[model samples]
Target chain A: MTRSLTTVESRLRKQKPDSGQIPFGRTFTDHMFVMDYEESKGWHEPRIVPYEPLTLDPAAMIFHYGQTVFEGLKAYRTDDGRVLLFRPEKNFERLNLSSERLSIPPIDEEEVMDYLKKLIDLERDWVPEFEGTSLYIRPFIIATEPSLAVAPSKMYKFMIILSPVGPYFSGGIRPVTINVEEEFTRAVKGGTGMAKTAGNYSSGYQAQEKASKEGNADVLWLDGVEKRYIEEVGSMNIFFKIDGEIVTPALSGSILRGITRTSILELLKEWGWTVNERRISIEELYQYYEEGKLEEAFGAGTAAVISPVGEFNWLGKKMVVNNHEIGPVAQKLYDTVTGIQRGRKEDDYGWTVEI
Target chain B: MTRSLTTVESRLRKQKPDSGQIPFGRTFTDHMFVMDYEESKGWHEPRIVPYEPLTLDPAAMIFHYGQTVFEGLKAYRTDDGRVLLFRPEKNFERLNLSSERLSIPPIDEEEVMDYLKKLIDLERDWVPEFEGTSLYIRPFIIATEPSLAVAPSKMYKFMIILSPVGPYFSGGIRPVTINVEEEFTRAVKGGTGMAKTAGNYSSGYQAQEKASKEGNADVLWLDGVEKRYIEEVGSMNIFFKIDGEIVTPALSGSILRGITRTSILELLKEWGWTVNERRISIEELYQYYEEGKLEEAFGAGTAAVISPVGEFNWLGKKMVVNNHEIGPVAQKLYDTVTGIQRGRKEDDYGWTVEI
Candidate 1:
């Protein structure tokens, strides 16, 4: 399933640096990997060309209709100066799953992985050597067909773009305050909640702004039906440490199937921790917190990794978790996962992909 | 609230005409209107510039994380040589609501309408007089800030583009066969199902594809929880006629607050038709259809106004509403709505906005 990459030297020569000022996502590598798909031609013309603007019709389905799906992972620079990707195969698999849900054509994971390798090879220098910074690789597919019918785009563009970014949390990791949202819901059962599509995030923005304006860091959504169950945080899958056990909302039809969340579950099981993936209502969590049985609360995802929740505001009432400090379980999980991610320990689970 | 005209030219010239042919979303007008928003400056730098490639960072939020929102409407040319819009103000309000949900800056609707008017005036000649053909306007906002923080973008772009479009159903409106989607949900309660964003539609692609592949014309989504209550049909809001009464899914928090849906309700009520915006479960509809009480079912949207539903497959069972004919109720609704839109009838509701 490997794809043969054709090089574009002219595109590579157009590289310009941003004063090398190491901002989050301001700078980009010279090269990118692109593949196009159509009803007649499955997926053809895999190329490594200069990173440039995509000339799309103003009415392209992606702009107006939002028929798009994206995957996020990182290309890290190790101590030995070799580039590496962590569980990119999982990302590709998840991308296909998202594409299937979005009606976008799926791609071969092996070929995508090979495409990533070639892209990384061309942009190796952009992989930052900083302790927390890495070259962020984004694989996304967007409907390119110029039609307004709104069924599904017959044509699509699959692209891989790289950006060097700093750590998500600027200051030291502190517990964030989250506001429970009653007015808005992110995704529901029989909805696109479980897929990594753009519309979910866009729709959550108004609520997010309300949360931030109300002095909270993120918005926590209740289930759309009863507005009772705790679904997820803004961009991450949430978990609650209760009665010496890790409990997260099950992969109900309405939650994104997060790779990091899945990895955390597997790693916790291997480390002899009881993990429960089931419906965890906000009422139950609040009751447990009042009874001093809720040990820790945090969110798991690729960008933030593991963000501890220090306080949560539910319907105008706020509660601090575990004395407003990072709980022991959260700290331990973060250390174990990040240690493996940074190649600071043994790759017991074979998660890292070496370049 | 009305802004003055700011004009720019088209940088790219026309590629010689291929034939006497027109396509959906392929061609674009010469100039585009853009305004940027920042926290300190609010929203400024409103310009009408040549429609050129946007030099956005590769890590732009819209490309990677999908922080975007959009609206769709059209400028119609009447036989009397006048341009009019069917309630552009409603579209503006919905756009702001969408922006608020997406955490993007909300612009003054009147100012936006003014810009749209100026845009149409400049591209007036592009408006085709082909019966039922009009210039489609797409107003979209995207998070342009180049950061990977996964938070809302600090900067945003509000732009308007125009495209000439023909009839949505191509030939005259033919009744369509709809497949009930049991596995995937388009929108769930408390989710962004209400907002007109990209993620929601993208997520429905798979279901729509499955329906089309299975010989169904469109996919109908049910409630996320029970998968029985009707929500919407693909891109349009649906209506059911039973026992001389009109029934539609209420604003159940998960259903899209469509403009066309609202107009149809008003129009139906004005015409002495009993309109009920309550939860109409699929089981109830099926029971009515079995007893020959279901008179008609159609989807209402700006694109087609109202498309009659011929047959629907529900839970492995099939039901024909009007024997594949355009039901009487559906025909009246469509004729009245489209008649008012195309400036062929009275504007009693004041829904039409003249350009």
Candidate 2:
């Protein structure tokens, strides 16, 4: 699958950031993967070119129609200097799912994955050696056709860029406050919620901005229909520990099907814990809090393996959890996931791919 | 804004398409208006430059977060060699509203309008003189900052481009068939539905493509909450003349506030016709059809002044209207609106602005 890709080395490599404290998505590596798709040629001319700016026609459909999809994953450097990727296949599979929903032509996920591995192998030194630092991989496809029609684009561009990111939390995993979003909807039942397309992300920026202004980290998104059941927290799928069991919102068409959420569920199942993927409304959660049955809550995603929730302020009413500190369950899940990702623990599930 | 602009004309102008029959969004004028925004300095550097490709980082927020807004309008060339724009302020005003929702910086409507007139003034010859042919104007703002953070971008780009379009109906205005979309939602309450943003447009491509494959011109989008009440027809506002009353869906927060739809309502009111801007469900519309009182239906937008709806296929059940032909009311409205635009008739409402 990597045979069709041509490689072009950069004349000058960028100065790698200090291995001490790196930031997210601000700096890039020396090279990137690029591909083009046309109605006549399909997807062709795969290449690894120098990291540079993209030249696009002023009327490209991506700037007008928001026809784009993306995926996020990371590559870690273990203590023994081995590079590993966690469930890279899942991200590309979801990327194709997103492209399909946006009416963009599908890609060969396996072939693209092979090309991605080859690119990463060439830049193996870019993966940071810090305990919490890793090289972040961003793969996105954008509609590049120069047209103003309200239909699907006849041309597209697929790209992959690498950036080194620090730990999401500067110090350690700390519980943060969230605003319960009731006035704004994240997605609708028949909308692009289930897909990882760009449209599903920034539409909730207003609510998140308002929440952040109120001294909260993010907002707890509710269902689009009744605005009752919980959908997600910020950009991650959410889970609650209540009634001595784990409960999370089911994949209700309008909720993102997160890869991290699936991994967490599998981990819990292997440990023989009770987990229910069903609708859990804000009202029911409040009731559980009143009865002292609501234990703790956290968000799950690729960026942050487990983000513990400290408090929820719903319309000015507060529900404090675990006395505003990280709970035992969240701590355990974080340690286990990060341990496996960094090769500090045994690879029991064969989830890591080494380069 | 016009005073801040600098001009650079193209040295080699491409031959213009022949005037026999033009297409939509395929050809452009020689120059375009470009502006930029940054946190340190607000929107600046307004210039009319040669129409060329834009150079941007591959990580531009527009491709990742979909934070972009746009508007559509037309410039008409009258028989007297004068160029006129139909209610240009309305489009700019809507563009600002869209910017507010998308969290992008807003531009001065009056100032930008002045700049737009200058751009169109320089390209006056590009506005075709045929009856239905006009210069289609597209004003858009995209997030240009090269970042991957999930928040409002700190930098932006604002530009306006012009394209020459022939009559929407190449021959006579033909009625179109619409599919009632019950499985996919275009927008939802508390969403970006009212904003003329990119995300709200292309997210409906899947449904629109499905409808087109079924031999329908477009889909009849319903309310995102209940999927019952009528919302829109593809990219336009839909109206139904039922039981001697003209009723269109209200500006429910989940529906687009179309400029042409507003003009049509204003004309109907001036003509002393019964009009209702409230929710009208598919069930009630079907009931009206069953009672033989569904007088006519049409879609209102900038590209197509009036797109008559002759058939509706809802879940395999069909309802034919107006004997599958354009109705008298649609024809009259189109004539009066376009007449005022081209200065063929009196500008009774002062809707036309001559350049």
Candidate 3:
């Protein structure tokens, strides 16, 4: 940890003071941690440098071929004046999982954790004091090899950059309307669906925009082949409550296994709630709603810890939740998680990492 | 065009050679064409700029959310000493179509073509003067807004970069092995399957790697839900020849409508070959292959004008195409397209765009 701090300090530079006024992702911290990988060297040249533009060949595979994967988490400043990361190890694990699918080299967990801690420590001032705002940390790996051939990149770069962000949902933990997209699938099984890769967001943008134009908040993607099973809502994993039992779409190889999603399941079980991960077809959910057994629905992700769904418009049919408000179950889950994240609740799950 | 040329010249910079080893996308030409879009300004500030690294905030939606789309085309220096684009308009049209599906702002054709001409004219020296090599042009758009919110970006960047590329199929126009991916689907119907977005590529990489490791050149992705019908072959559109008729998967809202694919169909029809755009399931293909009616299969795209497939391993069964060598029909198609591109044949379709 001492060596890591020293390395981070050496790479640190003066950050612009006016960054506070900038919007999320508009500005970066002074220093960034980088590691380069080559087939011969494996992973080498771990260094911290000033955050600047990446000098990549115009034909870099990431730009043209889209061989890139990234992860999003944050460093929060607790009331005790300590910087903490809520389950960052989960993010690290997910990043590697994405890396393996993208054919990028894996990083050592110990070294990566050390580097992340060091970076967060150096950029501690960037963490906002707002209740919902914090310093957003992005760790991404890209194929830096300059080859037009359609093969995995031989050279790669792993980079970490920090940005101060406000709340993920501008309107707070309010419910969101999702347009259940029967037109497009986010990812298919046997594909990189379960991986947190950049391509998923790009592919879902159209549906998202369509949903927004049609007076919805996000696009709810279904299985590509059948177009009936609810897979995900854009970037978040979805959970449905039917008859007091919480059901989430199983990690069916076609949906992202969100970290917050898994945590919520664990928390639900701890709170004595029946939580099951299984195939959740749209027909069953619609039927559950018809039978008045559907209690609530919500989405889970790193950014939006727990976003309750107000209603879902599927194929011209509007299926509203019982009251079009945040369900009590969802509110409790949000409070419990946010409490743990902000250090108000007991950290029994060992999810928080004090920086 | 005059105003665009004048504006473009202001941004042009002299090319700095990076050693003489032309690696794909590693080096760029002197100038890059760029334009911006906003709700107020629409598409404005069209200019050609020095090839440089984009200064993106770490949280730029493209970096985290993958709100990006791209098109690939090429500029060929024909034997007749003319710089011509192989069906540039088709790429332009397809790009906008992809943009519409991806919720990206669509650039006006006149504006884009004007900028493309300016860049090509400035980078004429970089265009390769070889039989099988040309300057590959990559046009892409990314969401550039600084907000962390998950909505359509208010601002966008449209960029065109050039790279000198050699033959796409290094081993010549020979058939390659493709593994039938039973578990993963590249894009799903009612999803962004037809749109050329980054998510689709990243999602397909894992299956592609698995296919290669399993002794196949590429993965033949099936439809998402059923995983039975054949879809596109990653970057290229899949095609089949059976009983002297050409057949391809119809654009059923899930398959990318490749320009080269449509071009080939037109060419086949011009040559009096029966061409059909309809759903042909994998089982039907195998049954046809077993009956000796399936003569050839190929993939069409800008990179590889046409790539012949020699064999397919579908559901534990290995099936071979007629005559492991390039089939007669594929050879003729390839000869026709490349011949037209290299100036060996006349551009009867008016597909070539002269710079």
Candidate 4:
């Protein structure tokens, strides 16, 4: 069943930031979408209200047990002023998967999509039309039940908020240096790695902080069991081009199935490129690098369509890929993905939807 | 530096629940302790305010990243009108340890202790005086910075709330049946397992739900890597009395450093009992059971104090322990620990703090 949207305008509208200098997730739109779930009633009272603080009991389960999940996507404003969303349905589908894994009651995907579109329509002005700017959407579910017990919460709150964000690379698309994480593991087999849950992100903070302190851009996590297999880059799916072939880690249940990563794979296959998804151990990668077969390395996610990896430091040995610069493959993939997202390229895959 | 406490009384105090019918964490006291932390100001404005809903931005990091930690302890009201706190310092110490791991700022132990005592004194009437009832204390820290970036938060809120809880075993210490979790592993080395963080608890919800559906009290987690070595239980530390010796999992980086687990080990040592803190595999446990050397099994935690395990079902095979009854060691340990906590027995270890 569809729920009608309720709107409450804010008395004081926040000043819009300059599209050229907009930082990620710091500024929000005037309104947000909210819905509540209870044991007796399903998700109800869908509404778009003025952006404000949420009042919760101190004993809320989200603060203690962390029964929470979230999804990230963006609304793009084309040069011709049409607002488009890139595979928004995929986000909601993943949100449902996360909810089930966390023992939370799932919401109606179509109904939530309607609510999301309504929210974006109301805040359409917040979408930026700059070349590298867009309106980032964050949808999350949290356990709101006021209990300290270690069990599934009986109450939940699902919300969506919008923030104007500038380009990930302000100057240019510069390759980044990564450190191989040997001490800290993000997720193991049969863990919550595949689910876009809060715990999976928090578990990587230590390693990320350590890598940042060591002058690295981010950490490249290894498998939890053997610490040999390459899992993923920090918050993004990783890809390597070795011997003129593109390879990415398979969905081993411990790596997030990124939407951008999926699109990249589809695009690669369409371009008649050899692409493989399987276990890629660190030793194998080093061997390829030693043989000068490792041509390019990059990370893919919604935030940065493609972030090239220039250097990798594993256990004190440094290996530079593609002479510490972006390779042809990474550049082409970036251009193709961004072109389709911004309506500059043909929508052969029908991945973007006009709202 | 110590901060002065400010008090704001509630206009409408809630009706106190009957101690005999108290449910864990469902009901809270009239007041709560609150403190705020900023990167520049550190922790400030320590106060005891009326228990009310906390207002937070919907994009708070705790909701999306799970950057939160919590500690559980209790305040017991002795028969002679004295409130006793068992090893409260230990909880705060562990809280600091958790903070370090999660990249959150640490709080002053002495100052927070002072704040906790003030809070308990204000709500001392809420402490249950029944034989198996006590005022449960939950102190937690959550990232409050309204940012969507996957990084440590700059703002935080530390809170302590009180809940009157009845005995964990309301049916007079009946042994519980446990299911050995093989498919869903809990935590692995180099993970956030040793810390009292929210992610660790949330990650176990799936396994716990599966066990509950299959008619079990809780799931007994194994090491995340091999899934063979025994780890902690759902919310407690597992212990076994096999071949006349007490055994528990060593402090592998993936198991929590439980406060109750420490006390139990100390008591066992003081009583001249053999206690081994090392890896104990499921195969070794089953071997002991087959040889009739498995004497008892129990779980240790703040809430339960001590809970005996009647049976363990591993891979469709069920093994009964101590003839499905509490062994002498488990009984004695429970009585001794509870005695020390409630001030019924002599406090030789200075574990109790008076407020």
lDDT of each: 0.81, 0.90, 0.79, 0.91
| Chain A superposition TM-score per model | 0.95, 0.98, 0.94, 0.98
lDDT score of residue B57 within candidate 2: 95
User: Of the candidates shown, which would achieve the greatest lDDT relative to the real structure?
Assistant: 4
Q: Note each model's CA RMSD in angstroms.
A: 3.5, 1.0, 3.5, 1.0
Candidate 1, residues B1-355, lDDT tens digits: the string is: 6545557677576552233246666677777788888888877778788765566655667766677778888888788988888989999899888777677778988887888888888788777777667788888888878765667888988888877777777766879999988988777765667778777776777787778888998888898767889999887999999999999999876788888899989888888988899988888889999899998999998777899999999878999989999998888888888888889999898988887
Task: Indicate the worst ten consecutive residues by lDDT in candidate 4 chain A.
Answer: A15-24
In model 3 chain A, the worst 10-residue window by lDDT is A1-10
lDDT of 4 by residue, B103-136 (tens): 8999999999999998999898898888889999
| TM-score versus the correct structure, for each prediction | 0.89, 0.99, 0.90, 0.99
- Tens digits of lDDT, candidate 3, B1-355: 3344444343555564433344555556777887878889888778877776676554556666667778889998887688988878777788888888767788787768878987898888888876677888988888777655566788888889888776766656889999988866677766677777766675676788788888998888787667777878878899999988999988877788898998899999899988888887899999999999999999998878899999999878988997666888889989999988887898899988888
Per-residue lDDT tens digits for candidate 4, residues A208-300, read: 988988889999999999999999999789999999999999999989999999999999998999999999999999999999999999999
The numbered model that scores best in DockQ is: 2
Model 1: per-residue Cα lDDT over A221-339, one tens digit each? 88876788888998889999899999999887778888889989998888899999999888999899889988899999887688999999998777799888998878887777777
lDDT of 2 at B241: 89
- In the range A1-355, model 3's lDDT, one tens digit per residue, is 1233335353446555342244556667787888888999887777777776666655566765577788888887778878889888888898888888877789887788888887887778778776787788888887778665667789888888887877777656999898988766677666677787777666666677678889998888887656777888887899988998999988877788788898899989988998888888888899999999989999998778899998999889889996789999889999998888888888998989988
DockQ of each: 0.52, 0.86, 0.49, 0.85
Q: List the residue pairs that clash in candidate 1.
A: A103-B206, A185-B190, A185-B191, A189-B224, A190-B185, A191-B185, A199-B199, A206-B101, A224-B189
lDDT of candidate 3 at residue B31, scale 0 to 100: 75
The CAPRI classification for model 3 reads as acceptable
Error (Å) of candidate 1 at residue A328 is 3.4
What level of docking quality does candidate 1 show? Answer: medium
Off by over 4 Å in 4: none
